[model samples]
Target: MGAEVLADKVYCYPFQKVVTGYLNKYPTPLEKNVTAVTTVEEQTDPATGIVYRRRIATCNNIIPSFLRKSREWIFKWSILKVTNIYLEEESWLDMKARVMNLKCRCLTWAQYASMNEESVYRESKHNSNWTEFSQKGTITITGAGYLNCILERFAQTFLKQGARKSIAIMEKILEEKYGSPVS
Candidate 1:
């Protein structure tokens, strides 16, 4: 059997009004039955002479997207789950360093990505530190792992042409966008 799957996702329910004339948003069913199991299994262990089993609780909020008057509708969401909830001081520091690096690259890449090429002025604007863009309008920036995967897979296309030539091409593109820089 696989390790226990802990709940990470949440849902939102709509407001309901009863004949009593009071309106309230429906509370999540799992609030009261925290340990209620939606899944159950049977197992026997000779060492302890007792059964060892696991359970999963499924009761949760009703999402309006899949709402029904007669049936409770639950939406499943993907959540980032850290396997070890507790972090050591050094480990946390290492994680912070790695995350900072990743966020730096993401922010750098996002700046250029967020611009509308048709109206953009320069690559420096894309490289600027303080420029901000609406998250809704910009593409969702992915983390470093996925970005690395993409870069590694396509490294030949980007790197094979040689770095100096690529730099020249980039500078030319920038000049076209913003006009030649002062000497």
Candidate 2:
């Protein structure tokens, strides 16, 4: 089984400012689960003037109590690794990320559970002063033998709940930093 999520939001801030905020959003109170962020690579394409960045962020495990013990045994931690491509000329940013269990070299369950997400940000067509952000993601659970179906359902539920909370908190942060949309 597979699950997908789509979210769209308009920010009053200009595209540049919105991009800045997104790059600096990790340390905010809304994302306390994130423990650290490290930039692994960065470069600019001379031909197209596009920028590429790769980052790895570590997050504390926040799984359900029932899964905590198993999670701890199979995975030492959770890490999100992402690559972002920015096209300033087009005022667009694209991101692809993978959420994985750290230290899972010899693990079975950990290999079956993973999360992949992709997102895009663009200057609003309605107004250049506003930015539009959209995200689409999928969560998958497989290779768990007989428990695959149950695990997939659990992952879907967990991700849905987390996404709702995170979006609410992120909106509040954006409002505080850029002020509410002039609507």
Candidate 3:
């Protein structure tokens, strides 16, 4: 097979200098990776065109925990969670367009934080016991019946063997007494 052309070059295989020169022009290439959840609504208005119409609403406020290179290429390691979630629908047409605009442009820590937060201090429907501790940061669990909440919320990700073993022992006791299923 004939050599490939570098941006429609006369030479069969452009030299490294030519290829590098071309790459230098762009500097940074874009990487498109996003996720989002959207909802749709329908409305009826006699003042407008038809009697019925659909509206799309969107939310675009997610904190991203990642690195950017040259402001063009982005490398995301984790997705952050947005503690506050809100949506607004103005007009019928605006709503329709907004719904389709819902998109996740970056990863957020919401899921991971939820899991970790749940495991650290949990509350349950039965018992009412709360605990407070500080590991990587200061954590204050609310009043009684919080242990259950932690267990249900977070997952353990320890590196040391002894730490894992200790957690396992504690988990076993919790499982025996609470009889709550592991997620």
Candidate 4:
């Protein structure tokens, strides 16, 4: 078993603007951990016109130094020696429906653990000028035999923190691109 998180938030901007901001938010000073982002694949559904995109983000390793003290574990898993980690994101945008869905997961440490996240942005039910955003994340550590419990907790916290950071980045991007908040 692992930790799971769920959250809901409202972006003051309308769905269109919010989605635009979300897509453009990257390489910002506020989030230095993410070094670069590249779009690897893109396709458009001929019938529904939904746009699908796959992107990979290269990020500076965020693992705490204390975790590195596990020399034997690190030695055993030589893959952990790398300095940068990769995150894969797939997003589907339904232009007519005004919704965006995304799934992001870890690619660098998949052997040792699994961190998967799903998120969505849609027109707010109450206000057309606002967007509703929700996300869920789950983290499970498989390689860390006994310390799995503690490591899972740490990873869960990290996952939530990453989500919060993205929200902040989106807010800033919206403000800069579209000016003042709608409401």
Kindly list the per-residue Cα lDDT of model 2 for residues 53-90, writing each as its tens digit.
Answer: 66665655554555544443333442112122111111
Q: Tens digits of per-residue lDDT for model 4 on 41-142?
A: 999999999999999999998777766654675346554557999999999999899999999999987888888999999999899999999999998888
Candidate 1 residue lDDT tens string, 58-157: 3222212222233211112211121111101110011111110001111123321221111111112222311111111112323333343443333323
- List candidate 3 segments past 4 Å from native: 1-37, 50-89, 94-183
Q: Candidate 2: lDDT over CA atoms? A: 0.55
The candidates, ranked best first by TM-score, are 4, 2, 3, 1
TM-score of 2: 0.71
Report lDDT (CA) for all predictions. 0.22, 0.55, 0.25, 0.88
lDDT of 2 at 104: 9
- Model 3 alpha-carbon miss at residue 84, Å: 10
List the candidates' TM-scores in order: 0.17, 0.71, 0.17, 0.94
Which regions of candidate 2 deviate over 4 angstroms?
A: 70-110
Residue range 43-111, candidate 3, lDDT tens digits: 555554322222222334333333212222121332223343332222222222211111111123333
Give the worst 10-residue stretch by lDDT in candidate 4.
73-82
Looking at model 2, the pairs that clash are: none
